[model samples]
Target: MAASSSRSFAEVQRRVSGVHRGTDPEQQLRFYDGWAPEYEQDVTILHYQAPRLAASCLASAIQGPLADALVLDVACGTGLVAQELQAKGFCRFHGLDGSQGMLESARRKGLYQELKQCVLGQEALPASSGFYDAVLIVGALSEGQVPTSVVPELLRVAKPGGFLCLTTRSNRSNLRYKSQMQQLLDDLEQRGLWEKVKVQEVERWERATSEQEAMEGSDYISGVVYLYRKAQTVGF
Candidate 1:
């Protein structure tokens, strides 16, 4: 990669990260809603793969009827995960996102059966307990996004023996947040809420890299995805 290209990518990363620099959820919503129009392009530029990689990982381990399985897609931005999962044979879907703009984009795809707007970590998840056959979230478990406290909520919404998959970036900026989330996951498992199924660290997860690692041709990001199954009986 040329020095000029590296510099250009770094600038893009800076602007993107700046949009969600604060803890104010409303401001972040506005930024994300406005970014909906160009969200795919920007993620493409960054080589985002949480959607596809997570879909593939879950799809491979899926059981029962694929065409009839109910899925709750948390933070279903632009329905990218829906698209990927649709390709893998899942039909029913419910999408949840905080950004109405992003929900509109996802709605246009005609993939989800329902779409709801809820600010994660701040608001209660608008789903019944043990309702979804698969409850999955991606790209929203990192810094400046959802908090680690929602781990139990995600598990609560998933049916007993159902799967819950989530992904988080494994980069310098998100390492601390990742640690907190991991501890929550472990705590949930200990309490017999869920059981760990699989964990994968995907290399070259995305491109365009990060501002902290800006260098010529150094544009591949890495992330980890975790899969778990809700316990059939809590505290049993």
Candidate 2:
């Protein structure tokens, strides 16, 4: 029993290390393309918990209904959360990510009215300013995945009063990443870029029913969620 437990802990640590190492845009795109098909399946059996929890936390942050609203799913990956939003009644939807291969899988879902390839951190938003009513970013905030610099750009494209919701793995104990994200949010708030509306951390757990599922789910290291809202214009 002791030997088995030690092996399990080591496997979990290895997977966590891989995610913490981060990846460049090109590498991320390539990785996602190769990972798209297996990604959803793996998430469904083992990885579904985080995205579902994050999306639920996001939904709770909004104040009003989103029936007629236009939403942007940044780094949408395979549109997992976008599909969830749509099913909940959001009509107009757009999904943007750097991985064409991932987008290919998202396109098949027939959810987004628009789907574009965007390299996070460097790629300019394809839409015009104030075009979306809300922007939902799930599993995007990280060290190498998305630079802190992108927060301002995200605020720029959202309409005043619109939502700019995002989730980042909780790094409260990791001062470096925590300070990086806090500073980014502070800069945006100081510039009147967006209002600090809601910020919360959620814990996530994964359980596996099969050996294959257990192997894939074993990779998740730390899981937490954060959200923010873009301030509405003063006087309407």
Candidate 3:
């Protein structure tokens, strides 16, 4: 193993973990803006797989031609998820995020046809109900980021018969958040909002070999990708 590679990975992991521990919006946005230039590089070092996992899951479940579908990617930092989806035959993409720096980097990739700025959970989403054929929000459904309440907004943007995909980490620190998210999904299902399409529990979500995270019994973190199909006859 290279010494320089290991040192660089550790530094990125520490910063990534630190970003999740705070509840300050401005501070988090500033941190991401500063980290935007090297963000893709750092996540690649972490072996982040949520974007790939989410795209694969959504692609397999969609019934129509992916190229004809319009996708809305929320919290689309650097267009990673859109890039993954585009590889799976999805062509049209619209993205939203809170960071201008990150969106600028994403624009250079040419994945999204439109990119808008919105502070999720606080600001109203700038989309009509049932507008998109597919709605995706990867890597932003965590506790210190977008609140669990935003899940409904994700559901709202999708067409009545469209798909909704979301991903989140499942580490020791996120136990309560995960539980709450699960409960919300269950309640929405019971209320006839959307039915589950698939739920994939990912074991190798990322490589965070830091001593603090390793105490969870492994050098890696786990995550889950949840896919749902909205009801065609009713809105919930």
Give the candidate number with the greatest TM-score.
3
lDDT of 3 by residue, 86-185 (tens): 8899999999998888899889889899999888888778998989999999998887887888888988888999999999888767778889999999
TM values, all candidates: 0.91, 0.78, 0.94
lDDT of 1: 0.83
Candidate 1 steric clashes: 0
Looking at candidate 2, the ten consecutive residues that score lowest on lDDT are 1-10
Residues 46-75 of candidate 1: C-alpha lDDT, one tens digit per residue: 767898888988888788778878999999
Output the number of the lDDT-best candidate: 3
Error of 3 at 79 (Å): 0.4
Question: Every model's Cα RMSD, please?
Answer: 4.2, 6.9, 2.9
In order, candidate lDDTs are 0.83, 0.67, 0.85
Q: Write the per-residue lDDT of candidate 2 for residues 10-44, one digit (tens) a residue.
A: 34434334444566778766767877765665555
Write the candidate numbers in order of decreasing lDDT.
3, 1, 2
Model 2: CA > 4 A from native? 1-20, 61-64, 171-175, 205-222, 234-236
Query: Which residue pairs clash within candidate 1?
Result: none
